[model samples]
Target chain A: AQTIHQWPVAEIKAVGSPLSLGCTIKGKSSPNLYWYWQATGGTLQQLFYSITVGQVESVVQLNLSASRPKDDQFILSTEKLLLSHSGFYLCAWTTNSDYTFGSGTRLLVI
Target chain B: AQSVTQPDARVTVSEGASLQLRCKYSSSVTPYLFWYVQYPRQGLQLLLKYYSGDPVVQGVNGFEAEFSKSNSSFHLRKASVHWSDSAVYFCAVSYRGSALGRLHFGAGTQLIVIP
Candidate 1:
């Protein structure tokens, strides 16, 4: 069975602080990875997606970037945080039909 | 561009009652449709999917959704609601054939099951 793991279940950061979120997928290789964000009461927005290692595509520009350094690793990061950046971040991977999502990371920016 | 719309922002139902959540989509081609459930502070879980063939698809927890090509709608239904069914439900659409294609999501409908 495949499993996804995300780091730092939750975080609270001040504005202007740097942030990084990581996801690792096991039992699958060369899977399509995606990053999604959702505000407290807003729709889920696709942030970025990667089909292979070292290549990523931006779906929506939220001033954030993603890197797929390895076959099973995906990272989302930003140099500085903004008040609007606070939300729930989700990591997902898809091979064919449906996507499998990780537990997710909750971020709060003050 | 492909898009999904979940009309009801919130819905309340008594436990053991029949329930339905509406969804609509706009796309140039026959797109893939899905319904996902998100527990509080958790990731979205696939409830059901519609690709081809049958218009009605069954999913986990006795949930099912029927696809209507003429109406451009895919609505989720459950025979009996439970208190544990309370959660936010999302409707999504994917146009591309490959897995790399991104899914467009709806604003989501919050389901509240009352005892």
Candidate 2:
């Protein structure tokens, strides 16, 4: 069985502070990773995706960047957080038609 | 460009009643269709997916959806509803061969089952 683990399930941060969210996939090797964001009552938006290590594609620019440092690890970070950046961030990986998502990280920027 | 539309933003149904959530899509070619359910404070879980063959596909929890190329729609249905079936349902679409292509999601329908 494959599992995706995301860190810091919930976070409360001051505006302009740096933020970093991490996700690690276990039992899957070289799987395609993706990042998605959803507002409190908005639709899910694809942020970024990576097919292999060290290469990532930006789908929607939200002042954020993603990196696949290792085959099993993907990181989403920003030098400074904005008030609008606060939302639910999800990490997912797909080997075929279906995608498996992480538990998600709820961010609140105060 | 591929996009999905879930008409009903919210739906309320009584337990044991039949349920149907409508979904439509816009694509140049046959797209990969998927239905996902998101429980509160949880990640999206795949309920079912359609690529080819059998227009009607069965999914987990007795949920099923029918794909219609003529209507460009894939509507989810359940013969009987349960209180536990309440959640946000999303309709997504992607190109056939581009598994890595980002999935275009609908705004989602919030289903509230009355017990």
Candidate 3:
């Protein structure tokens, strides 16, 4: 079975501070990866997607960038966080028919 | 543009009652449709999917959804609702033969099951 693990289950950071969130896929290689952001009680917005290592596409620009450094590793980060950046971050990978989501990481920018 | 619309933001139902959550989509052609459930503060779980086949598709926990091509709608239904079924449900659509599998999600509908 495939599993996705996201790091720093939750984070509370100060505005303008650097932020890094990661997602690692186990038991799958070269899978299409995606990053999504959800407000406290809002729908999800696709932030970025990567088809292969070192190639990421930005869907909605929220001052965030993503990178797939390795075949199974995806990283979402920013040089400085903004108060508006606080939300739930989700990582997902897709098979031919459906996508599987990770547990996700909660972020709070104060 | 491909998109999904979930009309209800919140729905309340008595436990063991029949349940239906409506979804409508706008796309040039019939896309891959799906329903997903999310427990509070958790990632989503696939409830059901409709690609190409019978209009009705069965999913986990005795849940099912009917895809209507003419109406451009995919509505989720359950025979009986449990208190544990209280959660937010999302409708998603993906383009046919999309290798990237990028999905467009609807504004989720929160289901409140009263026991």
Compute each candidate's TM-score over C-alphas: 0.98, 0.97, 0.98
| C-alpha lDDT of all candidate models, in order | 0.93, 0.94, 0.94
* Clash count, predicted structure 2: 0
TM (chain A) per model: 0.98, 0.98, 0.98
lDDT of 2 by residue, A2-103 (tens): 999998899999999999999999999999999999998778999999999999999899999999999999999999999999889999999876789999
Candidate 2: the clashing residue pairs are none
Candidate 1 per-residue lDDT, tens place, A1-110, comes to: 89999988999999999999999999997999999999888999989999999999998998899999999999999999999999999999997867999999999999
Ranking by lDDT: 3, 2, 1
Q: What clash count goes with each model?
A: 0, 0, 0
lDDT of 3 by residue, A1-110 (tens): 89999988999999999999999999987899999999989999999999899999999999999999999999999999999999999999997868999999999999
Poorest lDDT segment (10 consecutive residues) of candidate 2 chain B? B94-103
Q: List the residue pairs that clash in candidate 3.
A: none
Q: CAPRI band of model 3?
A: medium
Q: DockQ of each candidate's interface versus the true one?
A: 0.81, 0.81, 0.80
